[model samples]
Target chain A: MDEINLQRQSSTNDELVLIEEFFAQLTKPKNLDSIRDKAREFCQRNSHLKIALVTSGGTTIPIELNTVRFVDNFSAGTRGSASTEYLLKTEQYAVIFLFRHKSLEPFWRHFSSDELFSHLDVNPETNQVTVCPSFQPKLKEVISEQKKSENRLLKITFTTLSEYLFTLRELTMVLNELGSKAMLYLAAAVSDFYIPPENLAIHKIQSSEPLRLHFELVPKVLRPLVKFWVPDAFVISFKLETDENILLLKARNALKRYGHKLVIANELNTRKHKVTLVTEIDSESIQINSQNDEIEIEQLIVANVVERHNQFIHDQSSR
Target chain B: MDEINLQRQSSTNDELVLIEEFFAQLTKPKNLDSIRDKAREFCQRNSHLKIALVTSGGTTIPIELNTVRFVDNFSAGTRGSASTEYLLKTEQYAVIFLFRHKSLEPFWRHFSSDELFSHLDVNPETNQVTVCPSFQPKLKEVISEQKKSENRLLKITFTTLSEYLFTLRELTMVLNELGSKAMLYLAAAVSDFYIPPENLAIHKIQSSEPLRLHFELVPKVLRPLVKFWVPDAFVISFKLETDENILLLKARNALKRYGHKLVIANELNTRKHKVTLVTEIDSESIQINSQNDEIEIEQLIVANVVERHNQFIHDQSSR
Candidate 1:
């Protein structure tokens, strides 16, 4: 009876995840072609396929222009995108990249776009275009999203903090239904505070001078994962530093705050790329580096990320 | 009076926020070249400039790939380039662009060299190159770090998230030393987590198996306010998103995170370009829509950002 109930639950959950084409199409589209390619390359060749769900990009507080409200930052999506790409290079487990906006497109295009410079604009005055004067943004850069339908290396795009929150929440819900098939990579640049607009019209209509906006902290996404969501699942969360210039201080605090599997941290003005991976629950932290003259930073990041995913897969298989 | 401090602060702050070049090759440079251009156009006259601060290119994370360990990203320093042009557009702020790689000239030429693409291999039978159209690694997209003295833009090319953090830190330090005013816009994609391999031995590195990389988050350099480093300043940040999802969540989240006085949030992929001007604590958030044409999201962002700065000035004058 227990097994039967679990099976039914899984069926319903997959339907919900797959059925919501609106969420995928309207805001972010899943890169089916890439996913199919990934599926073919990684899963077909290697039977044991595990995945680390990685997310990146910035968040925002929604408010209108006429009414003085809200705050936000432009995260180039470097960490999240870099980490996801790095994890994929492992070839151990296929990666599920869930991201939002301009940050992820470049990576996908970099990997898939046939030519370079296809996206860059040309100057009318100098008549100069393309970075290399040779490479172009690739005519095939905008290959229809259709091509990626069968791909296993799928990248789902998203924008706005709430969209990401909903995404995380929904994915977590699916994970419970799937009975823990994948690990969670909590590297998304989620905003600490969110402003719940009191009244939409009143706020927008009352435009005299500078308006005031109030906010409160959003609920913790990862803490619940270990506590309520899924105790057995592997989890990793990111901690950004602003106050205590100390790197470990921030990472330690993050581990305590989220209770994830690992926490990564770096310091300011490091000439070369650097990251500190802090393992939660008593395991020692590992330091990863990408050299100034070595492999690109993003690939290295993906590599480590995948290694973690593989560890989980091996551990689960052992069990 | 309070009003006097605001305007005086605006002018005084402008000096430090603008770029400063001490290469000694150029006699003098101006500040905020875009604003200067506007001033000149408004007066329809010529204005002699003194100093130009050039911030060039985007950050590169030099990670080692396949033992050779060289890789890069898609930042062309176009935004910074436009910023320089805008500075020169005004002739008010001598333009000095601290740019990243691939965004400048000599560096661009370096990429065009045959030596760079010599690695491209072709099959004699098929006449098809293994990595055709472009064989060079993506990192070559990074702009060169070399600079010329006479250039109006002061370009500072960098790669890797660490380098970006370092460059900004050093630049701000220099600004403090010279007491240069500035209109600093927080643009460019900075990598967050890096492989923290500061102490890894080169020979000990294993090539075959997956390398377990632990990453720790890096600290933000902008933490130390320019007021402390280079007092009296103009600073602006960029935020991008799509409107198909939830805009309010994004808008409010951004305001809370960076604490920027003004945020320029736009919805792409829509019939009309919609931009919301956000502030930390403002009288109101203004939403601007222009279905008619592309009115310059870049400039519009700059203007809204400037409005806050202008408000500071206006309040100063009133006082």
Candidate 2:
């Protein structure tokens, strides 16, 4: 048993070295400083509230340096955005939302293009445009809620895998100042493989030839994120899978490997309606009631997460 | 020369067979019938006006059967959507817009999320939502143009390469009834390669393994599109390249091989401000003047195209 533990530790050290090399090769995002400044300002203004870093959407992997082509993961950012809205409603937490550019956002998700366009009325004579009567009440409520939370919410957008990882590291290091008061809610579907920059084509690939692509495994950064970046912060990672049988197993393995506080496991088909919260000792499933369709599963998931987080803070204080 | 001609004809026949097989293996989009119906209605209502089928945006290549990952070509549909708006302004043309889902659309392209959100005002007392005074004029103009052109424009959306090709074929066959009065503006950034259904994974690809992808060249349907489907229609294809030296060469090659009327060539870096219209006899470069910053280059390109299309129609009628 001791020998096995020693071998695992050595492997983790090698992985950490690879992760460091990955960052060294990547060009840091230009807006990273702005993101850090916004986070610092939020922390200073809402000193009494716990800070939650919520990551949403999927990171893209560019196939070439010029990047006329890219591999994109499927995510509309529904879970992360909805969770942020619910967490903000608790009033105990302020959120820094790191999301993919142009993905669904917190209050804005309610108004899709079709819904918004259909509900708009234009008066040609007066040159006036008005939101239709039926949509006004809902629009008013969302706008008011959005205005109220404006001070507490900080949004930072990223597109590529390198941008997402670099921003994640930068934001977490800044939030580490809060110690146990900070929470990391990582929900972005990050790429697991990427074509190294050295191997990427600099020009648009011609269509006359057959194409072959080779991708190396992307170095796992979650291990360093939990163990080094914010050791004192409560971390909750999400695992999404198309296969239900391996879902909980993978979630448990992630928690055991990373030593994070919790793992939320969801399957692709039933993700909106059901999820399992897995920890070191046991797992609990959270499902929305089929009879009441009005409630979002994120609302229930956020409530449960807040309760557990409160208990964690209490235990830490006592210790 | 006769032998070479025979060899080229045989290869094209083989390619047409492959294209037919490619479509057979794919599942048809559920909304295809509605798209067909919409095209029929537009044609019936606007019999007096010349018809144009304008394709925009980029098509995606799914990496798996269930499609959690896809390789996407880069296009914001700027040229296509802008061209559609200009074509409608002529009042001589009714357009059937076939575009990628969620890409920029005609008129709506002017209002991005930030622009729309910042220009909105909510009245607290009456729960009234109104467009701000500063934005009302532009909003009113766009809304009124949108309403006026509703009857003349038919909008159809597609996502994957399969959907785009299928819809393109269906719409062209329907528009063929108009003969020389119809124009085909093929502007979409379509995929050059794809993974056939037989080679695709059944579920989400696991991250634990190194990914190796093999792609076959997508069969060129342009040959059959011109020779068989709507052979009498005026066809204009686009060639986009990163290398400037090869741009005009490739554009001319496309016209010679496909026997199309024109090829619009543009480099990736200079696409927005400049483009070259390549025909069998000559090539002309249309550039936006530095002095005039207000006019879109699409307006100039559309004017040139309309003039050529009118000449072609006049020639056919005289024949």
Candidate 3:
């Protein structure tokens, strides 16, 4: 099929059939009920506080049932982890960090993905390895903050796209009672295409021949998430584009279709340096500067998001 | 085309044209000449030492030029890292580890992939973080061993399949003079198919539509390595299978076709527990037992391979 025809087919199929098929075919994540129970308890315990579910990293979609190979998005979980740190710094919200397995985490993102051996001073004479003195202050800060928020933060990991979708749905259902008090900072780079369960190869794909893979567009889950699952929650999504020309338009389209509160739009090259916050009413650009290098752009993003959430809560109470 | 036709086409095209096309189209890895120079220097300095080039982890194949998504093989570098330890235990060879980026390394593979925070003892009041005492001995051993081998082990990392092929060819040529003294342990899980340079999408593959990807079979590089690059090197390849029934047959076929010294055949479920050493004449099944629970299976695998290499060296001298 032509590219235009294929796009039309996918967008049309996305409306209802795709989402319904996805849920119907998807096997629930293992131990999901117990996780839901725990989330329920967490919500009940922290009724007075706002809870934010921040998703990070890239999800995988296995082409084989006994997956020796899979497709993956390019993400390091920098944005989500950074935002979580900023949110915690405010001390205003409890976080449920649903992240891709082995991706970066809050406070830990400062370190490079090398062996911890490099950060330690190994004294052969004494047979002791200790954290280097230069890194001590940051380590102390991270540990102290972590210890203080031990009960407030929950981390859940998923490697596959299917597991991520299932876990997300279950978490939202458990936190339904929190209503507008909850926020979804959707920063994960989720896979857009996946082989259907029935189509997945039973064995590792053999290397003896040419390969042709057919993938159906993953039915967009945002519609149900916004309309049905915790409908009153202040939801924020992300739009990552390489082209500057289509960035704002795509972000606006997503906000209109999903009926979410905000869309954080970023070009691939400038994502770390600048981002535009496209809300229903207006767009605001946030950028890093020479003075604010120590304080990341995420600090600004979180501040604006928190302010909007506060306004949203106020409007609900007034009504 | 039919499946049979596709297989035939791929196998026929793999002879010479594919390899030429791949090299011509591939962007040379940055600093490859410097790396080759270093390898030559290493060989000259350690001329008396038996050198083994051990490949580890998984290689990626980008679908687009600006890759937002890519296909990847499933490997954590466990086998390669574990084998490296065994090879070092013999105290006979210098190692050049060509590995996938962020995958495991020797000695450090003992630690889990989670944040190192869990392994630390954090004193919130004192504002200090220290490595937990119980894990001290292993950490010391790893660090000391690493320090001792600082000059012996050379690590080169690759993320993409094209880079891997380029690096491998260069390394093999540099080590060509070592002849039967050199061993090539091929353990890395490589992607079987890739979108050729001419066909790759310029931008990220948009998810707005059902996506059908066409991949050409990656040309087999083993033939050139065996016959042309380092013809007299003691070569061993791995055959990882999910099915037990066909494992031995596939391993035997690879040995026959490539004229390699050995093929280490393994079933995915039992790879860590058992492996079959398929040689030119016979297949030997090696299994782990309770008596040797403290020792890894790789120690045994490496021992057998080392014995064979010794015999080969002896045979070469006699001739």
Candidate 4:
């Protein structure tokens, strides 16, 4: 309960109070290097499928060599990662995730009740068992921790768009050889434009010079990709924006352009938002609205997405 | 280059054709199990760090819940595992990536471009190579991966909202001990509504009933999370949708609701989209339109985010 948790958290500052001091300490030598070997080891061990297919972290453009690849994306990996979870629900599908900085925290155990169990709490009014018996070391805790799926799927992270693209192109071939069941979901903040070839290394490296990275056109993945990779498998794409009123219109065009089974269209202002599912089956957009806490919108979508996929599988089986 | 790559692209349906026939043999093992092991190993090796900040693939919610959390989000990392590319960019962060089935193709080779280069070809019809020659032989490839000053930080990836919540809660304590110097970006598709505890999982797994999962609020990372982990380091959140023509109106509400820096807002339905930024300074909203692609949008937001963080760091140094 927030009531019990509040006792410990009451003193923690909610506002950005130490932005300067905290950030400065990070630059210190002691801060530059930290132990991530455990996390990396985790990625390497549980990955049932070794292949990785990333959409990077931004929107991608179709049909242009004079295009740019996103160095970064607004996509911190909410939807794509969630779907990745569903995809990982079974070993039949192996996943590779490359995410942005802000997006990596969830994977590290920051907000689970398990984490709360470890927090230290001391009753100031009276030394009391403010913590419940369940709080003490118990089998339930150990089982929860062990039955803990020990999520072992290779999850990689990325910040720039080029890295994602270059990685994907090759991944296509690998998955192609692996099976006819390969899939691709164009999620993330991929860019339609990339910094010119000449400037890629320098500009990306320098991190200076007015910072006017051009919005160049990126190659279209729909058709050529279909012709090239696992043509028989499924491929999904995305179209995002800040506007909520015109999702249908954008989805129609995106479906036509990408030919992906599901085109997810949504407004991009709050992390809590809604989505319009654009699929070819009926061309009717299914709007799903959500909030930040992720109780309502997420469950509906999760159950539906799983059911939808299950239906697709079921229909295939019957056929 | 695309034109040349296009020309060099062999019109060979050989691979696809081979896969099409093999499709019927679902039992035909493609040595994927070994690859899966390799992938898992990758995670295990990288799984070391006090605070691992990772994001899945969706948006976050915008409200509060039980005075604790709220509902929200849409991105499911059908493509998150490919986040390996981010690690390559800079060794500054530690990462563990678990991906979705649909996203494996995009980030397959990011961890090792040599594998990608092996798949390249020079179309007989055109002298140009379909894959970049500098990245040839896959064997000769050198990882030019950058570790943006933060790569050494440990990281992890989750597929479902539940998994994300579980892992997030676990990571919170580690970060708390280490200090609130990191950042969290709730950018995964965390389902807003969930199936109430017991029945929800059953309904979904057993395929019973119309799959009615009620809204049992997930924990809130955007608000209460800051109270524990990375409170001082910068945090960035996102909003995605197909509507919201008046960028300022949408962005203003986002800032007021979710306390994050640089909210990137855009129109999800338009081919030519625009992103409005919502930050501490431009709280009202500053739309950055783009007929090009998301890179333009990414650059705009990235620049501002970098600047803000840099400023925070600089201020700390001065102090």
Across A4-96, the per-residue lDDT of candidate 1 in tens digits comes to 999988885764564353234323424434544543444344335565567777664454423222233435566666565445444444556
> Tens digits of per-residue lDDT for model 2 on B206-287?
8887999999898778888998788999999999998899899898889988998999999988888899999999999999
Better of 2 and 3 by lDDT: 2
TM of each candidate vs. truth: 0.44, 0.95, 0.91, 0.36
How much lDDT does each candidate structure score? 0.47, 0.89, 0.85, 0.42
For model 2, the superposed segments whose C-alpha errors exceed 4 Å read A1-16, A289-292, B1-15, B289-292
Top candidate when judged by TM-score against the true structure? 2
Better candidate by DockQ, 2 or 4: 2
DockQ head-to-head 2 vs 3, winner: 2
- DockQ pick, better of 3 and 4: 3
Q: Please give the TM-score that candidate 3 achieves against the real structure.
A: 0.91
After superposing candidate 3 on the true structure, give the runs of residues whose Cα lies further than 4 Å from its correct spot. A1-18, A113-115, A289-293, B1-18, B113-115, B122-128, B289-293
Q: Write the per-residue lDDT of candidate 2 for residues A122-147, one digit (tens) a residue.
A: 86466588888889888888878887
Number of backbone-clashing residue pairs for each candidate, in the order shown? 161, 0, 0, 214
Docking class of 1: incorrect
Q: Rank order by TM-score, top first?
A: 2, 3, 1, 4
Model 3, residue A127: what's the lDDT? 72
Clashes of 2: 0
Task: Please give, for residues B127-157, the per-residue lDDT of candidate 4 as tens digits.
Answer: 3234334543332222112213223433344
List the DockQ of the predictions in order.
0.04, 0.72, 0.55, 0.01
TM-score of the second chain in each model?
A: 0.54, 0.94, 0.90, 0.54
Under CAPRI classification, how is model 3 graded?
Answer: medium
